[model samples]
Target: MLPDLAAMSSTSFQITATTGAFPLEAGTIFTNTVEVNTTLLGDDPSNNVAETAATVFPLLYIHEIQGSGDSNTMPGAIVNIEAIVVGDFQDNDGDLFDTDLDGFYVQEELADYDNDKSTSEGLFVYAPGATDVAVGDLVCLTGEVGEYSDQTQLTLQGDLKICGHATLPAPVSLTLPVRDISDFERYEGMLVSFPQALVISEYYNYDRYNEVVLAEPFVDERPFQPSAYLDPTTEADAIDDAASLIARSRITLDDARSAQNPPLLRHPNGAPYALDNRFRGGDMVQDATGVLGQGFGIYRLQPTVAATYIEENPRPDASPAVGGSVQVGAFNVLNYFLTLDDGSDICGPNLDMECRGADTPQEFDRQRAKILAALEEIEADVFGLVELENTTGVTPTADLVAGLNDTLGAGTYAHIETGTIGGDAIKVGLIYKASTVTPLGDFVVLDDPAFLDPNNTGVPKNRAALVQTFQDNRSGETFTVVVNHLKSKGSDCGGAPDDDPVQGNCNLTRAMAADYLVDWLSTNPTGTGTGNNLIIGDLNAYDK
Candidate 1:
């Protein structure tokens, strides 16, 4: 129906209306018409009326919302949308409100024939309530278009109908060995599968963040003093390429679980995700399928299935006779402080200052258990441990030894009494199997002459050098076991300070510690002064 233009006296006019609930779903199309001046014909009847055909887009295609131009959201358009479920936040349990993940993601079922790979084909459906949608379901939903948390998503408004079940589109194959977010921009919100197998190089924030760094090869720490050419242009380009390399080649696999420290990481056989230690950096996974996503300042692969990880890198037993008859081993405990982050002040050190290991009691227990399990697998008779609390009492070191020996049999192990050799929050510890070897002489610790002054501290700066002599019973050979924890290149030991090429804070201090170690060892710091010495610990320096 049209209002006569005679009253307004205009040759042209426009009409708008709020239509009834839409009965048609996505992919359905038909034509209709519009007419003018039906009641009376004008003087020129040929120009008095006309009919124009229109085809309804029941739901806007993902490409329409994600414009092919640039990174910008579609301003205002409330329309229906259709996509298949790819990333569901809801686990087997129907609970949804208990997590920070308030939405599931949907990706286009098929790639457009003319797609230029410029825009995302997937969109997150922001559903904070009970959800009827599941993975592999093709759904037609009417929702208000908007961006939440800087991500393009929809808020369901009217109907959410699961039309039917269909086979999901063949996943877009992805490969590693590159590092750019733009490479993934076009594939974002689309079902993507990787070709090369990837190792879970590291857990995202100790497994609580629910993500893993997947790389074609192993992930290594950035060098403290990165080598660069004098040519600024080449250096700048290399730096940029290096920066992009990580994001391009390595994809973060985000777990669908929303809880902190979930216990669901299991092996293919349904056991916990570790022989000891949660998926030791080299644990591998293959051909993962998920919706490529970007959020919270990170790009992620939200897997369609969380527990289907194939262990390409399985745990192996350590080789015996690693060294002499003692089988000595070196380990970086990753700040194995005995402190608990229990709310009460009674628990040792807090996470803020002296605390490094675990925060809560439960976290502490779990962390310690994992560490012990990992150590048990090492099966080392003598362990040179770094990142341990340098406290005088055995509250920290003795507790760890007792725990290890408990699984390894009581009276089997003993920790060296270094007696607070350094002022650093962490230091190296010496623990030996009492049955396999005997502590021959007193252990020696060299605190820096001035406790490490500025200018790379001249001395050790942070942790001190711990040296001991152990007698291997079978071979009857005594070797000097030197455990050293040097100044790390992390934190803010920058130009006002260390002035390192890489962001790893203190390069000079660690260098000075090595020099000091050489000088002191020549003098035989241990009473026995055995030339047969095995010097090991995290010196905070890389050979490459």
Candidate 2:
């Protein structure tokens, strides 16, 4: 206090104290005050006093705050707790969450665990500012409990003090297809290990989200699209029960970051997620250890250790040959619209519906090339295509046929003309090899309003189902091919039985469409009156 500063010079120091020396009890208020007086004129005495206060609260256990349910028990309540850091992800690098989650994960020491199976002992500390804590470091922090995006977190109210280093808790071993979905709640924010081999089930979001769905090896036991198997027309509770099993059997392996389209994407096996080192669906991962986290309404794992990967599902070089005189194929040419999806509404049959395919001619050409390449590989005598533009002249179906004939010889392929079957922006189409198969009768469409829109509002629920009879020139045998593009589960129909968490949206509409299709085919919709009938196309349902 006796040191005097010269002309605008100042000094910095720290005041330290030990709480044990004062014998203060819990719930007690402790305040420290300091004042400065200078002998200079107009020295701004108003800023001379500085004071700080800290209220002592009993140090609570991590499980006490986490409770036994999905949410924190003591939300908004201030607490002082000590734990060992398990995950040190507090760096400001743009890798985690696109720009740092600005926090780290801490869990109660083994000796301090409450030994409760339901309540979790781990917590995420939301410290935007830097902290010198590392994994295995024993630390004490005072913070208020809060929930962020359905995840429980503690916001630091003061400096986090590292007391000493300690051993990390053993990772909790877990397996997929748990008895119940709530089983994951107890392990949230905790270090968990899956010893069983988990198969990569989906990578639809890997390009943008850098995440893949991991599931059990057996498809029957894992979470799958329900409509693919459970015919909604059947009277069974299996559809509703599938949701529970799906929730328990599925979990996502996140890239430990939330960035979209990351420059470098890596799998949990330390392999780059690229075309060369691809981990396609059906690849196996063993010994996956990670911090179980919940975000974006789904539970994901932020890997803590590299897992072992086995390339079990290798890509096939060619389509397998079938035992049939004339080979048939079905494909969904995802929105092969002749017009661009460019903000103007001039693409559909009436030239008033909005477009939904390539945005430019160059993109269309690339898409067309890919489609033609796939078609060449199939080499089927007849093909059923979906998601084609419903325009009037030179429709997408004819354009595709032209592209095929140009690649093959002229008059190699031909398309059936239905003239925009339905009012939807997209429709189904049929094409056959003119050299292998001949069209026997005129094409027919099932536009029964009773089955599509049971309410009878005159509005079609989905694209009309097309039926055509084709004769194999080699055997001179005729068979009717029913091409269907039923209603998708993407959007709801604004009524009951249409939307189910397990079966997805438009279940009733699709079920009715299927029933009506079966009934209409029984009446021999095609004049060929052939008993041999084959239904093929994008049914938009899973084979559960």
Top model number, TM-score: 2
For model 2, residues 247-266, the per-residue Cα lDDT tens digits are: 67778888766667776787
Residue 447 in model 1: lDDT: 69
> Residue 81 in model 2: shift from native, Å?
6.5
Could you report the Cα RMSD, in angstroms, for every candidate shown? 8.4, 6.6
lDDT of 2 at 123: 81
Clashing residue pairs in candidate 1 are 178-248, 178-249, 179-244, 179-245, 179-248, 180-248, 489-504, 489-505
**Candidate 1: worst 10 consecutive residues by lDDT?**
221-230
- Residue pairs with backbone atoms closer than 3 Å in model 2 (clashes): 227-542, 228-541, 228-542, 228-543, 229-542, 229-544
